[model samples]
Target: MKDFLELLQRGARKRISLAELRQHYFSLYPDVQNSPDRSARLLETLRQLETIGALSLPAVGSWEKIGVPPLPQWVLLKREPKAVPRKDFGNVAWAPELGFWPELRPGQLETLLPINEFLLRRRGSLMVVPIKERSLEIYGDEKRLDGMCTGDSLFGGRLHLNTLGCFRVPQPLPYRMADAPGKPVLVVENHNSFWSFGEWNQQARCYSAIVYGSGDAFRLTGRALQQVLGQVAGSGAEYLGDLDPKGVRIPGEFNRSAEVGSPQVSPALVFYQWLLAHGVRRHRAECVSFDAASLERWLGAELAAQVAKVWQSEHWIPQESLGFEQLSAGVL
Candidate 1:
């Protein structure tokens, strides 16, 4: 009977049927199925609750909670409620008309229950704001306000934030190189390679810029590659990474983009061939099979076949294995 009252109080629907109540009772006591008088006992409990003005029968089949208010002590207590905690909102205090508590920290609901209930009743909305702004708006405690915001942004040139205000900056992806030096861009995978390539570029004067592929080349550098290639008029791009499944796969994925026009991106075949010649060991255990068909579409038949052979052998060569000295010696 107590369980039935608790269910009615927590339920979103104001009314329930006798059949539903019977199901609820049976669910609570599955063993009661074997007893013949189980239905009679369940009906008696419902009648007892109705007699105590805890529930009411509006129609022949349906029942609803009466206008009985919760004990004042229940509201006054700061401890957890006796009934099961709500799933959506954790522990909560019950009131007559108001539903479950809003998402809040432990003692927060206890201290601010009246204010929260008032806001809900009068405004018909929860007072939602950032944690730092809550005190300033609710209690008029201006001293508690602290200016802080969170998220990521990208810039084409530069930006400066001096005041407490929201700012939206356009991403620098699909980045155009304005008045860039006349040379093809070299995309380097590792940080060491990126720096080494930069130094080599200064001496050899080959690339416009040495872009960093940052490990996951496709996901991290795809948009930037497209932007750089699209913007630079006569300049092409080449990718240099480890001669592994992932490294081989990166260049293939980049060429898959329809937006980036032809003379499509290709792997640095010369550098890879150098690594193989220098006795770069096969990491057969780590190597996984490659899709020859996909590679063939992006890379020519010869390069794709070579990559497939390496993949099948489970052989890999990290770009770092071909030290800066070796890489600098082999010019693109």
Candidate 2:
């Protein structure tokens, strides 16, 4: 019965039909197929829940709607809840319907009555507080229903809380470019390769900045890279990755993302030819055919044909093989 209520709460839809419930139940517990009269037992359980006011069955409908009441306050309060000295607990509110509080002080609330009232009023929602415009604060407590309050540490001297500064719930790729360094940003596929370029740049100082592609040129990384490239136009961008199917696909994706007709290649055709001739090969059996169409679409026919030839020969050269010496020498 508790599982049933939990399932309904987790569902996006407010109501569920009997047929859907049976299907979901069987899917969740496949072993139930061996039980005799499984449907009858499930119906009996529903009837029991209806009797206890946990759910309701309409005379004219085939669905059982959730009717569980909000959890009681006593269930939420710690045996002896206590308020922190000189700290404000007024803003935090409890949400009993969700079975937890939001934005609560870590060690506050000595009594249960105040906390209970807070829970009853909010039901199960966090209380919104007035924050400075364009500013965002992170506050959530699954225990008490206090309104909202910002912590001193979060707002202390080092960091300013704002939309731009705040670490949003889901972070995008780590897209960073050095401050107005130079032209032709170097975009490397793997983190190791990006750092390798960083080390090489310290001495060679060829590129304005080095961007990490975070593998496969994820859409977020591509978009962020495109924006960074836009800010520094004439500089353009060069892509470098392993000489394989995925590596070829990444630069192609980047060209589309940056909306460039013909993007520059990294390591130069001469260097690529050298690597194809001398570079070590591993995972030959696992090497799959390259997507010739995507390669052609992004890298142009000349480079695409070169990569396809390498793929056909079952030869792959990782970017690391280029070595710091070759990289620093501006081999590309």
Candidate 3:
């Protein structure tokens, strides 16, 4: 990382005075105050740089020195790139799953789960679910409240609906790790492997998966995942998307949005390894899993081809096709 002080100085573009230079240096290394000689040495280094013409002296007695280059390109770039905002579900309506209410909110769900928010949208009266919670408070004038909260909705287990309003609650995903009795949970994205891993729960040892319903889920589901991982701390989270380029890129964005670390696996590599062991020289993407095919179809022909090139070059997987029996036998 660039030294923060240096970066700030570059942006200001003004010569620093001697006092300012000393203050800036000491601000970053407070311990330098304890050693006068060390502090003096630092000042000497700066002076030496100026003497050698590595820095510019705008005035006879100014403390601030202009850094010389190949000036870093950072000076040319005015603003840092803005990250795309994550999808948030907050404005969705709320109501009890079965209980009756006098009035209904425009959105259907009351307590938004993290997973639900990733899939939902807000427009007019619709809203994506906010972070996972159990309850919601009824602020009168749902429309007016909507304006304050923007398009995002909140959900907690406890509903403090003091005002007369409705609430909506949807079924939550059941995430269970397959192996250790109380092992850490692992969130898997692949649908088939998600179910298969669940089925092989006893055999796999421990760790469960949360399936990605579709490409759309990657956006909002990250929060839900944080919630899930929070409940199962120490769990090893893994994303099992396709080996294609888009699949690889999505995980990177997902990690940023969730602010969590979850490494992705290459199902194609797994399949490729399996075929190599089984003496199968040739295989198609769909043979390893049709869901992989569906993903390609969804991405469209142009992007799909781009992703294929990436998988073939960087993430070729040959063992993904092997069953658990083969895996356990070390045939892979």
Candidate 4:
């Protein structure tokens, strides 16, 4: 039941049908799937919830058209009827989007008092506080709230840490610079490509630097490119990766999310062209969903059309298809 409400709260759609619920939730939780008379029990649970105005069926096969807000309220009453939060909690709130809460402990109310005290102080201002700094100030331990922000665990059942108005500081990307004084830097998604590019740059001196994106690591750390480019005096950056949905998404998202004045990240067009013409293809069943607008935006019309055909065929080209020796031979 808790899982059911949680899924409705976070699912992309505002309302989920019975088929989607069965397909998604049943496959994910074994206990729910294995219950005796599970279908009957699930319908019974929905009927009971409907009677209480906790949720509504709408049609014969739908569940919870209006999500989240009303859900945690019913769940709170059902699970912890004996333990309840006081009405005087002021401007502080448990993030309404979350459809769950932590188990209330003995001194949980007392613990929540100070946590709310910290949150209330930050209520009106745009204070861009560091996550650890905010965590230490609110909770006693500096590392107490690490990895507890999303869907994991709510602290003390009364406070939502995500609403604390704090931001995470991303770490810098790992990179190697060419000894030469050129301004254009190449960003490589895989380590092998970075090594090949780095070795080639050492001799060819074609680029000012080569950045190792470590697959998806560059998404967060790549935000720091304004500072990274400042170090090398870089004009702009070109991104090259495996010709797949995820690889395309990495750079597209990275460039879109970049701060003003950050070095531009474009597809390593020349390298991608080579990969398109000669790169080896690996077939993957799940690589067919690259329908994001970023697909056309990042790769342009012509290249995106080619990549779309590859993705539709359920295949992708690896960056490694362009080897070390060829790169060292000034093959861009």
TM-score of each: 0.43, 0.45, 0.34, 0.60
Q: Best by lDDT, which number?
A: 4
Give the range where candidate 1 is weakest over 10 consecutive residues by summed lDDT: 69-78
Candidate 3, residues 89-147, lDDT tens digits: the string is 34434334323222322122221232133223221343333222211322222232332
Model 2 TM-score (2 dp): 0.45
Off by over 4 Å in 1: 1-180, 220-222, 226-234, 258-264, 286-288, 330-332
lDDT of 4 by residue, 52-94 (tens): 5545556322334453211211221122122222344334465
Candidate ranking under TM-score, highest first, comes to 4, 2, 1, 3
A best-first ranking of the candidates according to their lDDT comes to: 4, 1, 2, 3
Per-model lDDT: 0.52, 0.50, 0.40, 0.65
RMSD of 1: 18.0
Tell me the tens digit of each residue's lDDT in model 1 across 170-233.
2333222334466777777788877776766666666666667666634434445656665664
lDDT of 4 at 132: 77
Residue 153 lDDT in candidate 1: 14
Instruction: Report the C-alpha displacement of residue 3, candidate 4, in angstroms.
Output: 17
Candidate 4 weakest lDDT stretch, 10 residues: 72-81
